[model samples]
Every structure is written in structure tokens, then in C-alpha cells.
Target: MNRSENTATSAAPAKITDSGQFKRSLGTWSTLALGVGAMVGFGWVTLVGGWINDAGTLGAASAMLAGGVMMAVVAFVYSEMVAAMPKAGGEHNYILRAMGPRWSFIGSWGITGGYATVVAFEAVALPTALEYVIPLDHLHLWTVSDSDVFLSWALVGAVTAVIITIINIVGVKIAGSFQMFVVLFLFLIGFLQIFGSLNAGEVSMMEPLFSNGWAGFFTVLVVVPFMFVGFDVIPQTAEEVNLPPKKTGRIAFISVIIAAAWYIMIILTVSSALTPEQQANSSLPAADAMATLFSSEFFGNLMVAAGVAGIVTSWNSLQMGASRLMYSLAQGGMLPAWLGKLHPKFGTPVNALLVLGAVATIAPFFGHKALGWIVDAGSPMIVIAYFLVSISFVILRIREPKMNRPLRVGGRGNFGVIVGATAVAITAFLITLYVPGMPAGLSIEPWIIFGVWWLVGAVFFVGIPGGVKPGPNAEEELMEKVYARYPHRRP
Candidate 1:
């Protein structure tokens, strides 16, 4: 497509000083760290034992590999769309262009929920990790879902939530730097596990690798997408990335590969270091496995500390991703305009960040029992967004054949269509896993939460004005309608 045609299809290039725009300051390493850090959060530290029990070591690792491949396909679809659009709200922009505003709202809302849930998950997860290192005094608070809510424990997470929110509100650069620093510790923990496994791991400990057979494997497989959910943060912050569009796409894809390798290695290391009996008995298998391999409690504490770092990284990135997504939605008039307002000095989405941060802060009070429900509820939402994005990919390929895609997935012609179609099929199949009878079906609580979230989204969908076409002036048209609805806010 010519420059004129591209301009008509895509948003104008972002400027550093433009009002309500993200500052372009994120470098290659920071960008990669954002994606990697988001994916390699505390899940491995706390949930490894459950995975081992469900599918055994090898079975779990296989499930992770399979899920990673499926995500990689989705990543490719994201890469192509992000390269072509390179806007703030990753899926929102692509779906809006290809499928129009209503679908865009649905896709964007799905991802926003996914990111927001992770933000809350990390808030609870941070305190949980810290408890392994230094036990917090449980000041008796009420119990929810049979889990005690302690004031002291909840305070730790709530305080950290405030700090993370401040870091993000200060600037994307600061948040990216924090993410990079924390991610180094995450890498350190991974290397220690790998080294320990090589030095003292026992192959015999990996016996009965298949566990409960296909049923167990499928259970583990269903959660794989949730584990690798953070890579899409790259596209959400694409406007701030300093690299070329093609390079940005490549980094997003590479992050997925790194995360896949990270998870598989963790499973192997844990399996080799601990017997099945030990794993079953342990609360934190990965940490215990490291401590066992090294023969020191200090190493175990270090693993927990690294897990805390992982929590911070995930919290920071997801908060950033969620806010940008909200900003994008608001900017398009799908949400209230206040969320679109950037911090006058920091150039970050202040309202969006604050709103999400408030949710994160309150999440800790709900205690750890809510974490599972939040996670399960968020998984299908993430897949829903991915499914829509895949559909958008196919739509754009067929409708806008000459649209510029810097990092084209299958290069040109019918092959790109085939790749997109494959992504659509894979995501569609993955979505079915959440059905009530499916092996990976969500529990009752999560099902209720998921239903309520979409029902709320449906209200927003119906409230927005009709006939807002997706193009250069789409935002303006929607904004005008928004102002018409709430004239007092117009300026």
C-alpha cells in the first residue's frame, strides 16, 4: 500500500510531546524484559508441585510445550497485527480496523480483564511468596472460602501495589527499568535451578512421568495459555518501544520462546531434584527442589525471594498493560474519556493506572483463596481476546491484502492466509477447553465471575453510539458521540 493508503488505515505516527500519547523511551532490552518478566512470574515457584501432581514432570513439560506452540501461533498473529498497526491498545486497534468497533470493544475488554486479573493475582501472589521466606504474623481477620485473611499479610501486598503503581505513574521508563532489574533475579533463579539439576539431579526421581495419563495432561494443558499470558504486553506498549516495528514484533515472538524454555527447564529441574513423594509433600516444590539440590535452606529462601521479584515484575508489566488497554478503549470512546487522559508530565495513562491499581490494592484483602478463581476466570477471557485477534488477522489478510505488515508471518500470498486460519482454528480449539464438561473447565465461582464480567461489557457495548466506522476519524466520531452523551465533560 502507498503512504496515503496506509495513513488512511492506520493512526498517524505518535509524537513525543503529543497530549495523551505515550513517551517513546523503551529500548530493546527493556521491551524484551517487559515481555519476559510478565511471562516468568511466581507461578513456577508456587504452582510447580500442583503441576507435578496433576501430570507428572514429563507430562507437565509436554503440556507446557504444546501450549507454548499454541501461544506462539497467537503471538505470530499479534506480531503481524502490531507491526501493521503498532498502536497503544494491541488487540483493540487491530480488531477495530479489521472487524470494526463493537468487536474491538469485545476483544479489548477480554484482554483488559485478563491483564487486570493478573495484576490482582500478583498482588495476592507477592504476599504468598514472602510468607515462605519470613512468616507474617497473622492478625485474625475474617475467613473467605476457608482461607484466612490476615491484616498483616494483606498489608504487604497492598503496600507493594501502591509502590508499583507509583513506579508506573512516574513513567514507563521507570517501570521498564524496575521490570528489567527484577527480571535479572528471575533469570538468576532459573540459572540456579538449571545448574543444581545438572550437578545433583536424579533421573529416577522422574519415574512415572505420565502420572494420571491423558486426563492429568489435559488438566495441565488447559492452564498453559494463562502461564504464558504476559508476552502480549509488548504490543500494548508498542507505542513506547524505541525499536523498529519489525524488531518489536520479533521481540514479542522471542519472549514466548524464552518463556517456553523457562517453564520446561523448571519442570525438568524440579522433577529431577525431588522424588514424587517429596514433591507431593512440599508446599513449594521448585524452591524445595533447589534447596535439596544445593543442600541448604538459604538457597530455598533465595528461591522465594526470586519469586517475590517475579511477582513484582508481573505486577508492574500487567498494570502497565492494563492501563494502556483501558486508555485505548477510552480513547476510542468505548469507555469513559477520563481513562484516556495521560499524566501531564509523565505522559502515562494516569486515570487508567489508578483505577487498576485500586483494584489490585483491594484484591489482597480477599486473601489467597480468591487467586485460583481469578486465574481461572481470566484464562478464558485471555483466550477470547486471542481468538478474536486471530479472526481479525484472517479478516485483515483477506480484506486488506496490500496492507503493510513489517513482520509478515508466512511472507506473502495464500500462505499467510493459511497461517492465520491455523491460528484461528487452534485458538478456537483452546477456547472449548473451558466448557463445563471439558477436562479444563472452570469451577462454579470462576464461571460466575466470568459471566458477570462479560455481562458488564455488554452494557458498555450497547451504550456506545452506533455507526462509528473504523478508520482515521473513528476516534473523533466516537468522541463526539461521547461528548453528546455527557455534555458537561466536553471542553
Candidate 2:
């Protein structure tokens, strides 16, 4: 196993100075909000009926429960690694430490691809949602995959993308504050839905608890990983947190539990509020459930407002995460160094944020169908990165037995290996779920998306100067050289 880049010191530890570094500002609670906000995206609002219909009520909840357990186990691996490292590039640093630059590129690329998908998905999701709220019947400029791209609808998402991009580039502190406020609103809306369900909705409406047995269960299981992807964003922004390193990691764990419970409760409440026939007939079950149970259009509108909040939370955090991961790759000489440049005053990754912004703004032009397929394609890549991080954790345990861990988990030797092996086993199984011909096999369109993305990633991998190597300071040494090029950079 390769030694970690963090394990380096010839003379009392190097100062590790750099012109572009993030300011530490986030506390544990704010950090938790960020993670929870990302995980609980627009899916619950729009897709709850689909999930329940596919797997039935109890089966869907069971699948989510299993998926949540898998994610929690993966979070344990992340908790240990983040406490020990607490660096900017979450999986990139860990994979580089255990594997090498080549594999690290693969893992980093995987997550970057995933984050980019969510960013783009939210761009179109915003517009599609507003169409529901306002009922846009304008003429579309064109059509793709049977989805229209009307000027008014596209403008909503594009405008949101630009606004979100600017908010991120201004600074992390402002962004973090906004996240906390919106997440609280999201919780309040959630409580409204649950209370309405309890007061007027019928529990007897939740029939056919198990549908098609295991086949139905795995269908919901396949999408659960993507739903839980936001928990790792906590580690991606590890450098900016004000809490102790171990606590930052623990916040990630807590966020996972909260998000998981949030989804299950959403499924249960939606089930109670709508019968199977009503769910099938309704377009947005959660929102309609709100209006139906309470007999007020205002309640449905509030649920739509919650959907907007989900969009903001997911978009804000993912744009931050994607930019930082790109910045990290650039910092390490794996990407163009210019993309790594940070604002001298704001301390945000301006160039990186712009790159994602441009992509997201243009994605609405492609219509919602294509972007939905892109998100599905990117989901597998994210799992690949998670699997690699799990591998890195086990390797680090064996290689750096004495490394300092502020919040160490598992036992020494065999016990630690058991924890890592369990994570690896679970992640690997999730990866297989994406393969073709399986019960949870993805469609051919997503496969084409996967090929195109990896091909682009390969191009950048070929441009790195020193290539892949095995050593303690391989990435550290390479990144310092990149930093050397812009010695006196200013805002």
C-alpha cells in the first residue's frame, strides 16, 4: 500500500504555505445543514409516488433502510479518513494516498462527474418546477427527447444557475448562512406535510406493502445511493469547517441519518395521504397530498416552495463541492492550473465555479430528459469513487497504523479490516447494480453518457507532467510545483 501524502516531515513538518487557501468558517450545525440539504433534493417531492408505486410502501421503505445502512457504513469510512486528513479534496486526497495519481484521477473524476450532473440537473429542475407553479404554456424553441425547451422555462433555470454561481463565488460564509435558513424552512414544510397526513389522511390507504417481492425492493434500492450522495459533500468542504476535524466527520454521519429518516417519513406520509389510484393519477404526489389532505391550494403551493428549497440546497452545496474538487485536481497538476485559482478577497474558487456555471446554464437548453439521463449516468461514477475511498481507508489502516485520528473508529488490526471490508463489499454491490442485464440495470443512454465522460477525463489525465507514482509526497510535491508558477498572485 502507498503511504499517505499527509505523512510527510523532513524537518519538524513543512509550513505548507500556498497563495490560494480556503478560510475556515463553518461550525458543526451549519455543516450538517449543508449535507442534509444536498441529500434531500427534489426527488422526494416529485418521485415519491414513483418509488412507492415501484416497490410498494413497506418494500420501498425497506429498500431505503438497507441503502441507508450501506451509506452509513460508507460514512464511517469517510469519518475516519476525514478526521485524519481534513483536506480540500475529499476522495482525491485519500485515493492519492492509498492508490496513486492515476487511480486518484479516476476517483476524483468520478465524483466531479457526479457533482456536475447534480448541478446541471438542478438547472433544468428549477425551470421544470416553476412551470408547475406558474403553468407555463409558452412556445418552445426546440425539443429534445420529447421534452420542450420553452424560452420562459429555460430562462428560469439559466437565471437560477447564474445567481447560484455568483453566490458561491462571493464567499463560503454567506453561502453557509443562506443554507441554514433555507433548510429550516424545508423542515417546517416537511412538518406541515406530516401533520396534515396524521390529521386527515388515511393509514388504510397504504396497501400492498410488498410488490413483486425482492425485484421491487431492488428497484428503489438502486436509486437510494444517488439520493445519499450529498453526505460526502461535508468532507469535500472539510477545509472550511470551524469544528474539530472529528466533529466535522461526525456531522456527516448525523446528516446521513437525518436525510435517511427524512426520505422514509416522506414515503410513509405520501402513502398515507394518497391511495394507489390517486397516486397514479397525480403528477406530483407530495404536493397534491398536501393540498388534498388539508383541502387548501396554499398547502400544495407550500410543498412546491419546499421543492424550490430542495433545489437551492442541492444546487448551492453541489456547485461548491464540484468547484472545490476541480480546484483540488488542478492544485495537484492533474488539471489546468488556472482552474485552481481562488479569489484573492473572497477566497472562493472563481474559475472553477465559472466552469460549472457555464455548463449548468447551458444544460437547460438540452431539455429535462437529457439531463435526467446524465444524472443517472453520473450516479455509477460516484459509487466508483466511493468504492475507491473505501479501499484507501483499509490501505491507510494497514500502512499508517500510528497516524493521528481525532475521531478514530473501529478497532486495531483485524477489527479495523472488518469495518473497511464491509464498506468495500457494500459499495462494490452498489456498483454492480448499475451494470447492464441486472435487475437494477441502467438503460443504454446512461451507458453512452458514462463513455463520453470517461473519455474526456482520460484526455486530462494524459496532460499531467510527472505521471502516476507511488510515494508519500507524490501529490504534495506535484502540487507545490503548480503553486510555484503563480508566486505573487493577487485578487
Question: Number of the top candidate by lDDT?
Answer: 1
Question: What 10-residue stretch in candidate 2 is worst by lDDT?
Answer: 8-17
Clashing pairs counted in every model: 0, 0
Assess candidate 2 and give its TM-score to the true structure. 0.94
lDDT of 1 by residue, 397-422 (tens): 88777777778889887888888898
Q: How accurate is candidate 2 locally (lDDT)?
A: 0.84
What is the C-alpha local distance difference test score of candidate 1?
Answer: 0.86
Query: Which stretches in model 2 have alpha-carbon errors above 4 Å?
Result: 1-19, 465-471, 480-491
**What would the TM-scores of all predictions be?**
0.95, 0.94
Report how far residue 48 has shifted in candidate 2, in Å.
1.0
Candidate 2 on 1-491: residue-level lDDT in tens?
Answer: 22342444211111123445688888767798899999988888888898899889999999898889989999999988888778777888888868888888899999999999999999988877776679655776999999887888888889889988998888888889889889999999999888888899787888878788888898899887789988898888888888888798888888889999989988899899888888888778889889988998889988989999999999999889899898888777778768878788888889999999999889989998999899999899899999999999888788777766677777565777788899999999999988888766889998999999999998998865554454456565655554565454212
Clashes of 1: 0
